[model samples]
Target: MDDGRENLDREQTIDRLEEFQKASVRAIEAHGFELKGERNGVAVFTDKETAKRSRDTFRFIAWDKVSEVADDLIRGATQHEEYTGVVNSSKRTAEYYVRVHRSLGMIQLRVLERQDWEANERTCGHDFTPNPPISSISALKPSGEKRTVGFHVNSRQEKTCIELSLASPTAEFLTNPWSFVSDHPLDGGPRDYSLKVIFDQSMDEAKVAESSLELASRTIFELDIRNGISLIFAPRERVRVSFDAPREVPRIRFPRVKVPREVAALFSFASETLDNPPYVFLSYYQVLEHFLPMAHRRDALKVLRRELRDPFFDENKDVTLIKLMNSIERTKQVSEEDQLKVLLRDFVRVDKITEFFKSADMKHFSNKGPISGVPEVVMHLKSDPLPTQAAKRIYALRNRIVHAKDDPKYDSIPVLLPRSTEANSLKPDVALARLLATEVLINSQD
Candidate 1:
């Protein structure tokens, strides 16, 4: 008796499922969607008016795999909310559509059609050339691939449209933006391809306007990252930086930097400078200038006078006067050594310099033997406890390069400075400068 009762309950559940399917079909048809019969358990539907007007039926399919679509549509009709569904062609492509009930009397329809490389030539029909032609865009012509995104509005018919076409002799279209989509294959595909949004004629004008504005804003934001921004270098690739504003520059926060405001300003300036043209040298020099203390004649003279009065200088008046004048001249020169001294004054000990260099992961000073080709002044810093020796060597190298000296000597060793043409060879010095600047900026706040 228990076995017979279980069979009866199973039969009743199957009967109820079939009845629900039939009712869903009736409700779909009543809402002006034509039931185009079922194939392999998938039921297809087309809008009656769209089929009549274009003879191009907008096809949507419902199956047991997506039974939630039917349930959601039914719930939307009852609760007055939007319903959306997608029918995928492949793992990476699909056709998506949305139905929104705008009011008691009107409904909105939207469709997005996506095509992959396999269907590229066959999907559009008749040679599939973009309107106005892709040949007219010079940049795209040489790229061997073409992508076009166009927006149109038909006021007479009350429709807003977006069209995207990507074509290539090979399969480069599936690279950039498409690669990002392909990474997460289970999430459908890129949402922007060949999107077409439309609202019914009966929709309120104000509501329509608001929706249009929202769509425009979203499209612009996505395109800005897709086409405009490119991260060419890693975040840790540091550069020496200085600001035009002395102390009142607006600070911005950046990751890892303790004094973010100054660093942020420096990065902003560097970005702006790089965006203009190819003024890399000037831009880097400007950054280096910011860490340097401004040289005032009176302050420099006081320091020089103090030094001369010490046992370090001769007591002769002529020698003293000559030294004072020379100090003034050096201050006017804006030498890189002066900048380095100012930056390293507080942290000149060998241990401190070594610790900072290790933390920054600097490799410029690792080669210590005679065969390393480093100048004597730089080599002496290896055994010395003061950073002054390293600063002097850097300044000497800077002078030789800036003045274009054929053969400059540092502590009597023949040194070769990097020429303008040998920009790639200057990586070591550039890295050192960046590290030094970073140290200076961090200490400035304290």
Candidate 2:
């Protein structure tokens, strides 16, 4: 009787377990999800929305296990799109969009409109159709967060072609990872891109990108040198050149090569140290053939003084004397009526130009009257104006950069100056060094 009862109890337990499994399946199905791949006790669900939501929404996920992911995989796994569209407009444009993952920081991309489509067409072949307003500024109210989306386009297709092919800065993080922007509409068919939508609740601290006018105040003023030059030479064929080809034919090459380096160290020692010690020190035994040479400090200073007085000057104006003066200026934080002294102090302080000169001796004598803690600085020229104005401007700019303050009148050029094959043949990295040198040379003389 005991054995029979035990068998009955075991059968009842098995039945209950089966019932519970069925109920679990039923519950998942009711939620529009299916339990597949359960034969090995493993289940996989194919919910497009759920997977997409996981990508778009930022939450506390175990990122330590999956720290980094390539943009392509992210796009494929989550088909998020950034877009900005104008209603009733046929012309297409790019939109700025952000992709936020709980595991990864925000990935920002620009979503562009579908070009070559009919005005009445809803889609561009098979490409993603970008709609208006890339970001959702108003979406933040209820959950205390907003989700904005934006799109980017290869507007400068050919010019940016090689750079894109080379995977330039932040370009590797963009759509069509391996392919250039010109190769878009992949295979001449619809191309897919990803953008993220964030649910801000999970963020402990977050600052959203503002699209308002106040945001404009933070921007630096720069004339589009590339665009200007292009306009000036419109319909003119300067020359076509190949990257691998030698300089056999006259050709117009792209300028303003950006090679990343430590900028903070460059201006710091220029206050009192010679470029020799600083360059060697800053270079840290790295390749600096393109930057300042490790020549005698005295010789470098002589060349600098002559150039500041006359950027094109060519007189043996005591290179040794100049070097000695530079060392003294750097060693002490003293300021004098001499423009060169003011320039060194202002350029090296790593503060606002006005703040740097606030307590300096120039505050008492110069026509500008001690900076006054105003929004801007105006230096009146009494005499000797070859490149002095230019020199003063360079000093002020260095100060602005050091302090993280934006100068409304300053300009950011791809290349600080036009490339001249005759004057200075600079490699890509060398060009960056030259630009830094220009800043140092000008400030040293001032």
Candidate 3:
């Protein structure tokens, strides 16, 4: 029971992983799936085709820490040749493939594949029948805007949607085109072959796009488990250009003032992607919260000053005096939402925010609308300053993200599902959070 990982690289770990692979092969063989052999670290079983149709077989690097398992490689494996192995329970379609990394408790696969199951039915993920079974994707009820989704199933079990992923793609789209398909390779990695269907610029809701992408990629990867093709979406050029953050300007111009330790740490946390946008956004929100108390106090004092300076002020009047006293008392119970609005106005620049949102992509925030669709963050489309729009949108998204479904005490917000296409569209939101966090940290220096 040495699961503490002190035994990670011990010879016993390798022996256990080998035993597990042997047992999986035996169990899977019951349904006509046979372990042909092991090649490139993937235990090949009877799929539609043999391991390769020549060298065209998808390839991948074996994860060093074997125990982290094949699924863990699905995260960072965006390279051209890189793929993760999968095991399936169905006898009709594909079968067992092991990209075994003998780690800790994470290795068990009671149901096998990660694909969504219906009525706990572990059906084959591939299109084995002439008309593949209707998917939960239909429940999404996408726009009636002439998008006909095709469900193809051939007796040969070919990778139709997959093999064609990079067949023909746009070099770059025309300016303001209604829709176009583009294949973006993971930055310095392999081709992601992302076939994104889009709507008009104003309403890019995600359910349709996500469902399609997941189905297509999953199909290709499953068909070629021995080849090891991975589906990590974020490009290195996007999520993380480099592990190092740029400091050319900062090196030449030292800060006259210093940021508090907590604020600085949060700023650093927000700068890097901890796997996804939500995690990074949470870190940025933390930096913003560090100043809430001080900003809230400053806002309260401003109200008191404006009220006291009125020419009609009367010290003898009890009604007027009590009203002013009540204003002071209300500050003690002011919501963090109100304080966030104050923080934006007090520290963030209107001109800067307006400039940032003026870009074609940034235009999302210039008008009132929700990007992710979960929290329904609507920016202000009024004559008020840009910070008003920023405050409204940022606060709603922040609150929605912070509110977790689990843990009764922290159950103030609904859970933002990680796999939703809405979550995938968060790159723009991530950019916004990064910009806001940087501004607040620099402004709050002492």
Candidate 4:
């Protein structure tokens, strides 16, 4: 539901940033606000004035999530209100604020929340959901206390199957779950989102569901991050769903590649909890880092092979043996950055990297420089290839994400936790990390 639900999100400020491009015309207009104009990616709204002020007719300033609003619009609109919005994947639903008229000469926004605005009596009570003229609202009204959901099977065979059931009398009680936005701002916040997952598939009998538990578990974590709801699988727990799920097979796509469980888990883990930007970036980087030890060993193997190939090499002589030992030690003693460089050089495809950055979201990375306080990834053919530059950028970012306080290596990055506008902007970077990690994992195969 698009209705505003306000719980004390870790740092609510950053999570609540509204994107101007994503907000719909209907929702924006419903508040009696019109898209008066736009400049520099900001859509300025001029609605009926909140007060009978002489000069300032438009007085609401909103922060756009992806792009910064025009400074002129901000200065013109900041006479009173401040709005931030978030629209869901469907784009049909939204979670944003509506201005509640103030009597005490201060602005108030109506939203469902645990606490009042500065404990003000004039503000609407907690449990309040934004009343957006109702005409623009589309809500899923479940009939009874529990809603029945048809879970479809994702089989290679004809999916036109029969209804799935379980023998237990308590079958109805054991439904899969979804977290409504209102659920976030409340436990008692009037919304019944409890759902049941069933199909011709039975967990009790066949112990089967379309997607594997490991994959489903990862999806559940992503839901928690995106929707701000915590969902853990119940012991002896089962299946889940997506609304008209897309045709996405070969989750890795194309040729079958062997990736270790550890690497796959790390890669999946990065996707699941990405809303927490700093940690997510770190996690993604760790996917590449996992191969660092193996990378070191590969270098050592090369050194040993070179010595063994030399016909004049002698193990009996102290000088020759000591030289080999010295060579191996030197090979294994490269910096973390150097090891990462080795993995990228050995595993990832150069042209494919150029292709990866060609993505719409990722293109800006080539121009905008690195996320957080890190060096830019300068792509060159020979001296500074994409992989080497990538290593430099990733290592610098890793350092920044690690240290809690001020440090010379990463002082440019600040400590404003999940206040994640910048972190949220890191989807492209995350994708890059996933690409590199998957490449290394797949390419490392025998």
lDDT on C-alpha atoms for all candidate structures: 0.40, 0.27, 0.45, 0.45
What TM-score would each prediction reach against the true structure?
A: 0.30, 0.22, 0.46, 0.46
Which ten residues in a row are the worst by lDDT in model 3? 171-180
Q: Is candidate 1 or candidate 2 better by lDDT?
A: 1
Clashing pairs in 1: 241-287, 242-287, 242-290, 251-261, 252-261, 350-385
Give the per-residue lDDT digits (tens) of candidate 4, residues 1-446: 53222322323333334554434433444444454443222233444444664432321222332122232122221111111222121111111211222351111111111112223312322222222211111233333222222111222232212211111111111111113322221232222121112222233322223222333444346434653334332222111211123366536557577777776787677656644555667776888888888887887798899987888789788888888889888986788888989889888888878776654354445546435566665545477888887777777667656657856754556553332344445556656776787688778886
Report the Cα lDDT for candidate 4.
0.45
C-alpha RMSD for every candidate: 21.6, 24.3, 19.0, 20.7
Whole-model lDDT, candidate 3? 0.45
Task: Tell me the tens digit of each residue's lDDT in model 2 across 352-389.
Answer: 33333443344332335322211222344456332333
Which TM-score value belongs to model 2? 0.22
Report the C-alpha displacement of residue 47, candidate 4, in angstroms.
5.8
lDDT of 3 by residue, 115-184 (tens): 3323311122443222211232233335422222222232223212222121111111100111101111
Stretches of candidate 3 off by over 4 Å are 1-250, 272-274, 360-370, 374-380, 406-414
Q: What is the lDDT of residue 94 in candidate 1?
A: 17
Better of 1 and 3 by lDDT: 3
lDDT by residue for model 1 over 348-410, one digit each (tens)? 345656654555433445444211334433333446534565565455455444454345444
